[model samples]
Target chain A: MTPRLAWRLLPPLAVAALLVAAWQAWVTLAAVPAYIVPSPRLVAHTLVADRALLAASLGITLGVALQALAVALVVGVLVAIAFAQSRWIEASFYPYAVLLQVTPIVAIAPLVIIWVKDTHVALVLCAAVVALFPVIANTTLGLRSVDPGLRDLFRLNRATRWQTLTRLAIPSALPYFFGGLRVATGLALIGAVVAEFVAGTGGQGAGLAYQILMAGIQLNVPRLFAALVLIAAAGVVLFSCASLLAWLALRHWHESELPPR
Target chain B: MSAAPVLAVDAVGHTFPSGTTALTGVSLAIADGEFVALLGPSGCGKTTLLSLLAGLAAPTAGSIAWWGEPLPPPGRPFGYVFQAPTLMPWARVAANVRLPLELRGSDRATAQRAALAALARVGLAEFADAWPRELSGGMRMRASIARALVASPLLLLLDEPFAALDEFARNRLDDELSHWWRDAGFTAVFVTHSIQEAVFLATRVVVMAARPGRVIADLAIDAPFPRGPAWRASPAFATLCADISRRVAAAAERAA
Candidate 1:
């Protein structure tokens, strides 16, 4: 990495280290019960011991989240494009999309589970619904919000609607699409966990949610902390990956991704 | 000389939906290779008339034709440079300049070569990879002009393209644009409020009246090509500027 990037990465890395140190020290100094908040070292040990189970559960959860994200991206972009092209379609469906967004995922996940029957299907559906709004909203806004002068220039050049969208609107919407994806990445993970929590399933019992619950019920605090750590790590990894992708795509051109002086 | 006029605006008029009349009975005929400046006060519909010629907006009355053909769909007939440099912020200078060619379905290599040549024409060949934000205002305008000229347009329409620049930058661009116009030999219809700019760059300056714009006078500059600062200090230059300024003041007064 360049010195500029290394300098930027340093502060966040330091903060994370500080947080881990604080957690370890607090657990030891306060004589806190492991069942309440396991020491960072104990959590690390538990994670190593339960690697097979933890890895399996993490794989399942990641799979579900990724599938949901893919669905959200495809459907959300199609919907956004529809809204961009037709005022009538936008008027009819945009409010319904807003309704979907405002409706609580936890409240609706159980109903989706009941309706879908299959646990994986239910999880994917719930996650997709939860993540759909941002992509649609951001992409649509980007499509419609082109500079008027550029629009005129394009029009004067005899650019067709498809030409405008592919050459201009879609490229313009890229930052916004990635903005939505960053938000949706976390939401997809949350949706998978929430759906698994609501709809208990057996036979390779789906994802980290089941493992977390089992750890809690068995009074295995270190294991519970390990599972929680995995979830948090997954979220951080997703966020960092999404942010990196955005930076890579926009770094050369967009102001948002410009390296510091 | 026997060819049809490159662009003809036949008694065109327009009014906004809010009931504000922008133009009334504005007629102009531009031959191929002609450079015309529409000089007027702000809100005099000079830009609006250019928009009509560009086919961005339909005239409320009468019509505009290109080379005896009715204006092709709003975007196909001419290239336009707005007052602001409307380079896409997310695109590289090369990508921004290549937009018109891309829209026209040219292959990437062909587009890249044309875009590079156009950038070289505007002295921005070195900055092709830079983003719009990285460039100075004059550089951005150069990119905009490069984009306009890349398609080898039949007609180039500009709306006060240099009005925002400082005197030094503006005058330099004026010289560059005049050179480009002379060599490229495209019909140019430039709209500017500056009497100096009108006289310096145009073969003919069409003075416009304000508030429902109408052409008040059409004065031929009859100056030689590659007009420099020395030309600006010449007696003929002063006479034309003074005459146009007087006409503009009279038009503004009539509107008031």
Candidate 2:
């Protein structure tokens, strides 16, 4: 990497190393029992030893998060377009959208799981519900935020409604929609993990949250620390993926995505 | 000059929805290929009148007719240059210029050629692929002008297009615009608050008074074609500018 990138990566890495060293010293000096708090080295060893099982759980959680995010994007953007076309439609349905947003998905996940026969489908739906609001709100605002002068210019050119929407409104909304997508990606991961916790489903289809629960019940402190590390790493990976996507979509023309000159 | 006028505004009156009377009994007749300048202070309804003439809006009372027919739709018949550049930030300069033709369903190849030619006219052909933000303010305004001209409008309405530019850039654009008008031979109605600009470019200067704006003076400049900086330094130019200045001040005072 370039020196600038190296500079950016250095501070975070240094702080994390210092904190890990301090925790290791405290655990060894105080003779703390591993059952209560595993040393960082023990957690690291468990992560390597239990790689296969942990990797499978991580895959399940990541799959659910990705699927839920896709569903949210497709449905949320379509609903936002409909809202842009009619103030009346937006007024009629926006309150219910807010209601869905306000209600806790964890409370509703049980009912969804009981009603939906497929566990995966139920979990994806739960995650989608938690992630849909920002996409709708931001995309709607973007679609409505067309420059008045540009709108007048289009009108003067006698543009058809379809032409106006495709050429103007959609492109205008792309930046805001991408912003929502970033937020939704993180929320989808959180929702998936939370739903898995609530369902407590296990065996072949178990996600990271299930592994985490099992490790805690067995008092396998090293395994618990390993599961926690995997979840944190997964969250970081999901966020980086979203950021990359936003940068790719908007780097050319968008004000927010432009690099400093 | 032809006896018959191409467009006529007959006793036009307008009161906005907010109960502000913007214009009252404004009347003018524009001859073919004549460069008319609308000179007035702020809030004088010059822009409102331009918008009406461009058919962006209808006058509240009376009528505006084009070639004795009903007012035509805006784009091909009338191109408007707003005070600001007003370019689509997402579009490249060429695409912005090609927009009107695209809206009219022109073939892509033909529209591209025409857009390039228009850009060439404004000396922006080299910057067709550049984004609006990459350009300076004056360059952005040129791109705006190129977009306005791409459709080959019969009448161009400019609403204080150079008012925001520095004095040097403004004067340079004024010269370029005057040259473009001479070559294209299209009817132009330029709205400006600059007294020197009004004197420099117009074939006929229509001085307006504010507070329900109405025409106060209609003076015809008898200067020759292709006026340059030499003409700007002439005694006749100074005399005309002074006369218009006095009338404008008197109109403002009378309104107060």
Best by DockQ: 1
Question: What are the per-model numbers of colliding residue pairs?
Answer: 5, 0
Whole-model lDDT per candidate: 0.88, 0.90
True interface contacts reproduced, per candidate: 0.82, 0.58
- What is the per-residue lDDT of model 1 for residues A1-261, given as tens digits with 9 covering 90 to 100? 998879978999999899999999998999999999999899999999999999999998888888999999999999999999989999999999999999998899889988887789889999899889998999999788787888787776678998888878887888888899899999989988888888765449658988888888899989888988899899989988999999989887776787667
Which pairs clash in model 2? none
The local lDDT score (0 to 100) that residue A225 gets in candidate 2 is: 91
Candidate 1 lands at a TM-score of: 0.94
Please write out the lDDT profile of model 2 over residues A18-40, one tens digit for every residue: 99999999999999999999899
For candidate 1, what's the RMSD? Answer: 2.1
lDDT of 2: 0.90
The parts of candidate 1 lying over 4 Å away from their true place are B1-3, B73-77
Clashing residue pairs in candidate 1 (N, C-alpha, C atoms within 3 angstroms): A155-B75, A156-B75, A157-B75, A158-B75, A158-B76
Candidate 2 versus the native: TM-score? Answer: 0.94
